[model samples]
Target: MKTAAILNKNQLSKDDITHLLMLQDEHEIELLYKKADEVRKKYCGDEVHLRGIIEFSNYCEQDCLYCGLRKSNNKLKRYRMSVDEILSSAKAIHDTGIRTIVLQSGEDIYFGSEEIRDIIKSIKTKFNTAVTLSLGERSFEDYKMWKDAGADRYLLKHETANVKLYSMYHQAQSLRDRIGHLLYLKKLGYQIGSGNLIGLPFQTIEDIAEDLLLCRELDVDMASISPFIPSPYTPYKHHQSPALTDTLKTIASARIVLKDAHIPATAALSALDEKGRERGLRVGANVVMPNFTPAPYKAYYEIYPNKYLTTEDPVKRTLRITAMIESLGRRISASQGDSLKQKVLA
Candidate 1:
């Protein structure tokens, strides 16, 4: 493929990215994945960063069409962990020697800015870990407060780049507003993670390309390219799950486009296929997020069904992921897995 020929030049236009995203031939796709894996090794090295995710709250206010936690899901049960409970979970993650703890939830307002800042402060104070927040969009003050509290990173996946599709799914706000929050978070000195969703009903390859372009434009430090796993309680419940091939292609493309960014082998892939995460690592992804949300709440925090893997003991889970990473000929890093681009700039 001529696309692969130019990938080495680091001069991809939207059309070039689109061409790579649209690679339908199995051989061509495999070649693309190979090049992406090479880029991942060359830029990020062989250390797989294990980020433990604590889904502290299932409560969300957004009514997006695809989410099981959307405000529209009346049948879903939601809960928020108290400060002590969250601290306990963070300690569990810390004990596993994981350097990053991602505090993720729906946009649950129950925990105000002070509550979140306290959580961030406690995690940093108690452990040698960096904090990443995925609590949806908040005010500039809220973002800045969390940053001041020692939050090291933030991940807000810009689900789609097409304005029309973004408006369709995100009825409450515009794509422009979402982008504004991400940019503001960047200004606050957070290692930004902005990503796109693949396999929407009417989404085209061009839309995916635009997503890659937006990530590059924002200079995101981390990115996630996961398939749209249709959820039962949402409007997209009847929609078909995206093919694993397409999602893998998108992941590889992100690795090539955002060469130094930390891309995860998303769980949605593993849920769709047993070997998804392994396949993701084979292609280009360099991070894996093990669910550390205590088991009682794990079953209920159903974003998409059959979540990748969770266990009663987070230590055991981390050990399992550790073996998996080492088996892949990659070592799980003890470092915080900070962005390579930022270090280069510094």
Candidate 2:
């Protein structure tokens, strides 16, 4: 099939996306990425927004098969930051003039409602910056307490929108429960963020299309999509990872489908392709999450294989990504307001 013909098929159905994924032609994928990049540039412009991420805890209760820190993995070292420690980290991030701090962790049982609330309160009071929580699923009361404590956004990736495939990865977790939590978060007036992995052991392109459709249906404020990277400790270690070209195509298609959601040029995307981050920005991704975790704990913050481990040095990763954005004719803003919302809406 001609590249132009494939690109012109604007309303990509499940079958179409599936067909594109199956095609192993490198030339076709590159052509699709270039076209998608052009479209992304037209809509989003040549600028990247940076979000500083702090992986607060690695202690998780869930046993997700693909995650390195799953509860079943007893070999993994687990750690949780005290409220004071968290506040100190937030203060350092604030000094960098990065207004957004993403407080992410695996679903840990150690921090109950009160502890989580205290952490959120401390960050909000001390730094006076936007707080985003990605601490796995929580109850309505817990979410409300955090929101009331001044959390502005929440990210909970659905992992995969396909129910059966979701079951394959998450044996103990329920798809209904995950979806309900996201919907509940939305109802609680939190800026909801949900997404899926691009390629998994059994994921089809139709599954990816369904994920995009679900994001639109939910009216999500942020959509984080990353290509599946196999972990050595995980069950699917030997499975082939998604091709870099396929990953970029998914990002481009996502930009076209969910034009108003904050799409991140994920570290996984960048890890897969040499210029994946730059290409993603050109193809509709507007947010880049630079790590802000302290150096001593950097190696322990692995969610997937070969993840970009950021140092305690606040501006190291941020500055590098900023320069890359500049090289691509884009600028990274020091001000951390919700520029994502503004750009998506514009």
Candidate 3:
């Protein structure tokens, strides 16, 4: 009743929000998840969007401390897929009934604006799938070019809204610049997707609340609220990942607040706990992005270890995910899983 009352009221005190964040008991956690799922059903419906992610490259220029693909990590082998290989992967994803393909890579400059443009253009021209890019920060011209090339969305995770922690991990970058990129992507007509990393060192409950608040303020099409898993090669590798319960609390709170935004039951959550993703789905997540990156590369694109989102074989993986979705009594989304916010504005 307290949860319902707090959510129902137009405004909640910081203390009320802090209470929401501190919910750790199984019964209260279930209540929070149930409420989030109900709100999700109200806004996003029962269809779970599956975005086939192809990790096309691992070459990065930035040395972000927590990521394995940082520029200074010479021990990690790097590879960038040719345009043909990427297109071939997209075609395979389309063939398997996936409506969207996310071309995610490290912040590598090997692929120039025209090169990335050509890849985006080819994917849009050849397949019926929507293209989403996660190529870190790029020039405004590059963003405009890709949008003109028919890229449907751009995902640039804010990572965390706390400026201090963000600066500590990102070195010279500021939260303002990160947000500026998201705003620029939005201005270029791409459905902008931004999210936060839960359970980072020095992250507080207030920080978690602010993350959701920022997502609402941005009116992002998608918000990825996943638990933080420290990479082996990163500086804070020995640091602990977020507790599963803490992750679920953050996910549920985001759902209740964002309501209509598409939140994925992230692979990181599943990596931490075998049923974590399923629990997320039961609560608030309406999307699952299975790795469609063909093998040898999929295992190599390790942002964190022990990620088992999908197998090398796309066909078998699709069947397995479909069965998993069916088990949860949710239908697989058949369309391009376009932003529900877009429809709301329309």
Candidate 4:
């Protein structure tokens, strides 16, 4: 199939998506990126939404093969920030003009749902900002509690849509169950986000195509297309990361397929290349999530090795990120960065 025709299509079939992902010709790939950029411009404007992430805890129960923070990794130094510390970091994020506060941690139920709910309430009351929870998968009751406590969004990356691979990587975690949690979160009125990792071992172009299709089917408010960077102390430590071009193509394709969804130039991209985030913005990504996890803890929240900005001061990093966004002819968003989709609860 011709690249032009594929790019011009209003609706993409699974086969069409597969073919686009398989495009190796330089000119055709460029066309795919151009179409994605055009679609991004039409659906999402030139404002790069910033979400300040605070990885408060590095403790995780499940031992996923790719993550460095897995429970089995004895070498990792785990720490959980106190509520006062978490609120302090959130204040730092707000002072820098970031409106979304993303409280991300591994699946550490030690904080209990009520503890998390209190933190959510404190942040909501202390600062007029959006609170996004990424504390792994939790119960539906816990989700309702957090929502009632003023949590505005939830990010639970489906990681991959292929059933066999999902089980293989997540230690038998069910993809159906993950999807169920995402659906239930949306049902509770929180703007939901989910995504897949590019270039996992044994993953094929067909699998990636299915991942993009899943994002569209879910009608996610945000979709993150990030590279699979191998971590230092994991089972797939030596596996090669995906090519930069492949990652870029996936992001561009995602924008074309899910036009109005907020796509982020993820921090993992920067670990792949210094200009990875900027490159992602040019293609189709409209959101940038900068980590504000305090130093001692930030360095330990290494889901992957050589995490971008793990050591930089949050204030300095925010300034640099602001300058970088401006360099791309984009401005930082002032709103709490609400969902682009029209509200229709399931």
Model 1 residue 224 distance off true place after TM-score fit, in angstroms: 0.7
Report the candidate with higher TM-score, 2 versus 4: 4
For each candidate in the order shown, give its overall lDDT on alpha carbons: 0.89, 0.78, 0.86, 0.91
Q: Judge candidate 3 at residue 14 and give its lDDT.
A: 60
RMSD (CA, Å), candidate 3 to true, equals 1.9
1-346 per-residue lDDT for model 4 (tens digits): 5789989999988888888888899999989988998888788777789999999999999899988999999999989999989999999999998999999999999999899999999999989899999998999999999999999999999999999999999985889999999999999999999999999999999999999999999999999899999988899999999998899999998998998899999989999999999999988999999889997888888888764455779889989999999988889999988987753222
lDDT per residue, candidate 1, 1-346, as tens digits? 4865867667688988988988888888888999999989988889999999999999998998988999889888878887888899899888888999999999998889999998899899989998999999888999998999999999999999999999999898799999999999988899999998899878999999999999999999999999998999899999998889999999998898888999999878888888898999988999999888996887888888875555548788678778988999999998998888944321
TM-score of 4: 0.97
Q: Model 2 off-target regions past 4 Å?
A: 1-11, 19-31, 307-312, 334-346
**lDDT winner between candidates 2 and 3:** 3
Q: What's the candidate order when arranged by decreasing TM-score?
A: 4, 1, 3, 2
- TM-score of predicted structure 3: 0.95
On residues 1-346, what C-alpha lDDT tens digit does candidate 2 reach at each position? 6555757876666666665556567777666667666655655665566778888899888888888888777767778877777777787778877788999888986889889888888888778688899999888899999999989889999988899888879998888889999999988888989988877988888888888888878878888989888777778778777877677677767766666577898888866766777777766687888777775665776777664444436776667777788887777665654524446323
Q: What's the CA error at residue 89 for candidate 1, in Å?
A: 0.7
- The number of clashing residue pairs in model 2 is 1
Q: Looking at model 1, report the run of 10 residues with the lowest lDDT sum.
A: 337-346
RMSD per prediction, one decimal?
1.8, 2.5, 1.9, 2.4
Model 3 off-target regions past 4 Å?
A: 10-15, 307-312, 342-346
